[model samples]
Target: MAPAATAILRETFGFDDFRAGQAEIIEAVSRGENVLAIMPTGGGKSLCYQIPALMGEGLAVVISPLIALMRDQVCALREAGVEAGALTSANSPEETDAVLDAIGAGRLKLLYMAPERLASAAALSLLRRADVRLIAVDEAHCVSEWGHDFRPDYLRIGDLRRALDVPLAAFTATADEQTREEIVARLFQGHAPRIFLRGFDRPNIHLAFAVKNSPRRQILAFAEARRERAGIVYCATRAKTEALARALQEAGHAACHYHGGMEPDARRLVEERFAREDGLIVVATVAFGMGIDKPDIRWVAHADLSKSIESYYQEIGRAGRDGAPAETLTLFGPEDIRLRRAQIDEGLAPPERRAMDHGRLNALLGLAEAQECRRITLLGFFGESAAPCGNCDLCDAPPQLFDATTAVRKALSAALRTGERFGAGHLIDVLTGNATERLRGLGHDALPTFGVGREFSRSEWQGLFRQMMGHDLLRPDPSRHGALRMTEAARPILKGEAAITLRRDTIASIERRPVVRALVRDEDQPLFSALRAKRRALAEAASVPAYVIFPDRTLIEMAENRPADMDAMARISGVGAKKLERYGAAFLEVIAGEVAPLHPARRRLAGGEAGPIYDRLMEAQAELARGPGGTGKPLSCSHAQLARVARLGAADADMLERLLGERRAERFGAAFLEILRAGD
Candidate 1:
């Protein structure tokens, strides 16, 4: 609708035409209409304001909460050759003055700042002088008191917009109808806007969940199947972040730790390293990495339970930002649920906030124990109508649901027969026909319901109980470590007052490769391998990992584009200025002409730690192990020392100390003195 917007969209944003909902949103704001845009993440939310700002008659002041995201968006605009700048906490006085001067001169198109900075004299003076075209608020949901990440400053944003006397647009990835209404009341001061509620559907990511049974093993197996894949593993605390990171590395993953606990500088370094990788896994706490800009991350996993469903969805949306297939795995159990509940119950949140938090937590629990398509369940929460997405775990491999009425009656009878005094383990034994000493000692084998539940195995019964607990149909007695305690919902199932049906658990007869969500058939291998070879060759000369040369999304992009020339190759995503200059010629040659076959001496993963004793070294360990020459890493440390040091990150040194973990101490010992003295 706007010529300047059309030109910018075509050359810079790479769109041939406007998406279904964009042109209208752009036109409204350009015509001075206040607007609310509820686009999904990776949707064109930025454009709704950005296009209008560029084409409108005056400057648009964009208020944002995250300094990191502000910097990234500004950088992208600058890269597109637009006149945009950010007023941030990181800017020095001189930098701030320069930015203010540019805005006053009408030389800046978009100016981004934190809401708290509205009080600053420099920011205020600039906004007063510059003709404000549109006031754009990112994360508008933060103005809602019930929303997570609520900030007091966000409550004042409406006043700021009114004082500036500009038509405005507020955007958020989440907000139920109630939350959206509250956002309008609080953010725009009851002056509602033209609303755009795009459907919430991240169809690229496949959702899955597992109960916490050997969670560590489950995480390792998940990462193993996604070997050479970029992913995130979220931990509940900083210590857990580091522990899981070390565990993944020791198991031969390129894993690293990140959290708010780390020094800012250290966290920045880890973030920079991960941004360039195809498969670098970052194990982190929730407080860190709010808006990572990397687009190639293939999956997101939770080693612990998420606090709420909104949080869970936001986190999982990080995967498949490029619209490639990705995976999400969340493993949780009763202990996690209890711990989360205790935190909520003990927190200082207001009564209404507490009620909203409980509702969100219930939504997350429902997702984990759901029997239908995970995507459908997710969209339904956001009030969007979504048909079953056939790609998720439940849709692909449909579970067999069985009538659990008979099983429920038997379990209730057995519990009552045993005086409801025993925990789940004891109750399970009574139902599974396990004539254990405890059962016989209590003479509970004589109960009418005993042996009646033999129709289902122990696993099926446990799944039923877990889902039942999730649904609030049953309770777990906290004092007895979650012993089954029936509530009113259970009475109906047991007494035929209600009929209940539940899906049978998929009997995992084969040991599943936990992380292998999508497997590439052999027919797609040649092109994939050839594309990888090109990526590797480029990475080698640059001294970066293969993924650093081009993320998996870039390789997939290349396979999809197959551009026949250098210009087209340069236009591919992730082929920025640095890559264009460094690896352009060699890569173009591969795409244009490749006649070579595999040769005997040619090997990838030459530096892979698993291939040799030297390959076992993490990059830091490699630096520490260097002897300036050809001294093999194995000869540098005594075999006993290497074995002793493998146990470094474990809590108890006495356990697995026989393997690796104590290298520094054991190396300095007499057994390794000969090697150290020789400097080998």
Candidate 2:
């Protein structure tokens, strides 16, 4: 069994070995045991079930939450020569028929469908006949209402599991202890499965956070430095997505905006474009990254603060998926923290749940202001421990800290003396002794705390207050419209018994950053561009995402190695048998500066055994262009039709005529059938 699994890993998926935890999960699932794998984003979770599916009998039913994800996985599986199909509403009639046909013929090894499909009686009936051997659920955390991305449809998965009576394997990147219990309660009905808690640390991703200083320019500068890399810039609001996208585009970046607010078609177009196009930056809200499976996203930048530590981890996890060194930058300010706090407080959750939510946000803040290693704090929040990682901003350039006990006391005193009903701006003004109409009207100018904080400048006091919020000593009261209020943690500091330290550099004062390390050298830029151009042309012509043709990592390898032939190109990672056969010659021609008029239709069939037969069929049809007697009008079948016929090996004229129709079949059916028979 091990030998067969390894062979499948190499021959079918082009991977020599399973990633760290994948082999164990695959083995357990192959042995007919249930599995719950908590792997990281790029942790090869798909293979845990994919390999098992290949090893097991009958079809492996995959329950995915998103159509794009299902489509991507199916396309990738087909590219690797596995028999996979998806039953999605996004499918065209021809696509649906093909999937149904594969199921009926027992030719499909993996069948992917949305969780919503389980709601339909007809869909459930179809699955009943599918002879499902295992049920694999992707993004399995959605089953839990406590999870950030809960879906009501995922509740149907447990019913489907019992109906199929097959071993179930669930996969997700983010599920806390509460969410995990909820998942088991709902999906597994309180039964324990083989739970594999893979570590959440994504060491390949460089985590950095900055105070939002000229945020637009900061983001633009980041984009300009990494000129043509595929990255995502997540904004807090839909309006921000559009605005930031326009800013990046105006600054001469290949950028677009995506949000849930857009029309479905428009959002899909962006998703497709992002998948296909390299060096294209997508400025999106949190709605964008959940279902994305693109592996070569070089970086992900947050223009604003993420809602929670899990969210931050998930968003940044979208980068460095290929296990290459990827970078992330999250910019946050006092305003963002206030907004996040208010959002959590304003939610309709119960008091205990809201308090837990606040604690989650505070954990994220601790990481942002961490004087030690960011990774340690972040992992620690998830109940893991790690040494200081040198990759984070705090580790690389430690912030200068100063004791702010006196300053915080002054700020806290001002808030208390002023009734704690004003916002940060008003509080700051009173602390700095500013005489204004609002202060005069409130008679807060007579307060002793006023003018006593004159030792610190207004900006300095603002930074101190921000640090107070970071320490959980102060919070913006939602009931009073973001009024500054002291928490229990502030008592000791207010009494001068406890000391607090603050970073001297305010978030807004941190200077703009230099360029990040580029993925490729300057000299290799041209070759990479040319390779991307070839990939784009092929993808556009085929109406598939460019990554489906060849991912960036593959293209980078090609650009670096400048593979001289099929054999050399075949050795590149991600250059599977099918991809090498389909794209090797075209890329080679580009690298070697040779011109090849690759017929668009023939290109689709290039690497398969049927490629030669497809060419023969095309030639036969061209010869009969004017019909049997060379007197009729020219007619031909589409390349897809010819390729299908070639692969189907239709022997008789009846089968050939059925596929090509009467007129075109009369013109070329005899010769096409002859070619198919001869090839056989």
Residue 124 miss distance in model 2 (angstroms): 0.7
Estimated TM-score for each candidate = 0.75, 0.84
Candidate lDDT (C-alpha), each: 0.70, 0.84
Query: 39-116 in candidate 1: lDDT tens per residue?
Result: 777566787888888786778889887766676677666555567889887778997787778877888899998989
Best candidate according to lDDT: 2
C-alpha displacement of 477 in model 2, angstroms?
0.8
The regions of model 2 sitting more than 4 angstroms off are 512-514, 559-568, 588-680
Over 4 Å off, model 1: 92-98, 349-356, 412-423, 429-460, 477-484, 506-555, 566-590, 593-680
Residue range 351-415, candidate 2, lDDT tens digits? 98898889888989888888788899999987899998888877777778878778888888988
